[model samples]
Target: MASTIKPVLPTSYKAAVIEAPGAPLKVIDVTLKKPGPSQVLVKVLACGICHSDAGLQQGHFGPHLFPRVPGHEIVGDVVKIGGGVSRVANGDRVRGTWHGGHDHTCRQCHMGLFQICDNAVSNGISQDGGYAEFVLLRSEAVVRVPKDLDPAQVGPLLCAGVTVFNSIRKMKIEQGNLVAIQGIGGLGHLAIQYANKMGYKVAALSSGSEKRDLALKLGAHEFIDSSQVDPIKALKELGGAALIIATAPNPKSIAPLTGALGAAGKLCVLAPVGQLEINSFDLISKAASVHGWPSGHALDCEDAIDFARTHGVTCLVERFSLDNAQEAMDTMIQNKVRFRSVLVMGSE
Candidate 1:
């Protein structure tokens, strides 16, 4: 029993597509299909260009199917809803994340770990995403967003925001604990604000001194330039870190930070950086542990957005048009973007 109010369906729409690996994304017209049961058609308002998009386009995440639309952090309006869909309705603002669709019967799903479900379907990887005028999203994967929140800023919250927020929440660090956020990039910037707002003594660590002011402006109590000093020794001097969240993707940068943890300290890695050459003795000596957290489910995304809204935390974004997606993604890949790059589709 669903209401049937739909927008004028377009026969085709513009999309930025990757025809092949290592090829530039081309803006082209693609045919559209009516959403099937349990699905909803979204008029994409904005989408965040994440580092993962660059990795997928470069085939770093293994071989990818050609002609894919690569953008996972999606924010849009539910224009049409198919039968049996009641989670959202037409005119409702919604957001979708990396955790798209999954089999509800799986053990992971039953336990509310939909992000790690055995048959999880990635929105932009396994299927088409919001690098287009319109996107068809599985209803179950969609979460209602606050209508008052800026659509452009909330897109990254669907992925990067949720990932870091969930990871920090899992650490269960107490208030006033010393927390170190490594790499003042997209994820690190948000992590710093979140940790500080959560009552932790936040320290922002990066390779150079360029981001010192920016980090402090984002609520960090201190900033450490790793290139000028030994970061481990620096942290130890300040009573060590109760929690260190590594957002930098380079394993070399992460390996040394492991030794900066204090007794019973936890090191949480949010980057997709491939393996780390950690000294086991360092971990054993401090009774510390290293853990990795992936993106969260819809409820987690909602929680992150709510927390950010209440605390005035937001991502600093560079805007781009759909036609300029290549340039936007290139800027992100080169690490030239101030923080995040978002493709704004059109006005709401």
Candidate 2:
């Protein structure tokens, strides 16, 4: 079957190539390789600029791998399939995981939690990712895109959407529960919408009065400016929040909110962290739990996509052409992007 399909290679396809940590990104022409066994080759339509890529840029996710392409929130169409790849075929719209492929025979995988698989292949860190004209994905890493959805918006949904949605689900947060989503940036903005759709009395927790109006308009029941009035106090006033999902990695910004949890409430940390210091008795007294969630497994990813498609959820993405890779990365670093930044390639 592999021999039947002729290999196609086009010269001078541009890709964002990161040669080293803390260095400027370069746009270079790279040769495309055919799919290997159990791999699918995708012509990227759009890829989101994720903070995980920021971590990759700063060497936080371990030693830097030079000549790495770093956009994991990918939405594209499969262009070719390798031997034994039955999950998807050419021209199928898809989005892929940040953790590319997990060893499915592991105990965690058996339990349907592949994100924590003993051996995981992470895009842009341990493996090549989506900042190129073509991306090679293991068969299990890809998820089908709903026909009605915009591929650009779906890119962020693959990562941030699943992260927040899964965390919200894992916390077992109930409808009508007071839920506060900290940070009103990329992840937090979407988290607010998802929380609202799930019937939570959501509050957008940000640092200033500036974002308050926009947050409320986005379905947050109320907006709390942590810079002026105390956010913990504001949230606590709402019968204490049943859950707080911290999407920002700033430890200091999140630590103070721990005490604001309602009776038996839980706080789920979805973003990466540095250090957070909290009093032990804060949890002991309330019987609350502090849990950390990695990126989602296959099921969670599916649920996120379905929820987004069903509820009209979408990222407010600013699109850039594929050749403007450095500009996109710089926009992400400057925090200038409103919600998400995505690079668009061939026909979407």
lDDT of 1 by residue, 12-32 (tens): 999999888898999999998
In model 2, the runs with Cα more than 4 Å from the true position are 1-12, 346-348
**Residue 329 CA error for candidate 2 (Å)?**
1.0
Please tell me which predicted candidate would have the highest lDDT against the true structure. 1
Residue 10 in candidate 1, Cα distance off native in Å: 2.1
Candidate 2, residue 339: how far the Cα is off, in Å:
1.2
lDDT of 2 by residue, 1-348 (tens): 123443465754678877887766687878878789999988788888887787787777666587688888888878788999987877777887787898889998998888888998887778888888888898887888865688888889878888888888888877998999999888898899899999999988888798888888888998888889888888888888899999877888888777889889888877678677875787899888788888696567878999988887678889888778778878988999998888888533
TM-score of 1: 0.96
TM-score of predicted structure 2:
0.94
Cα error, residue 60 of model 1, in Å, equals: 2.7
The C-alpha lDDT values of all candidates are 0.89, 0.82
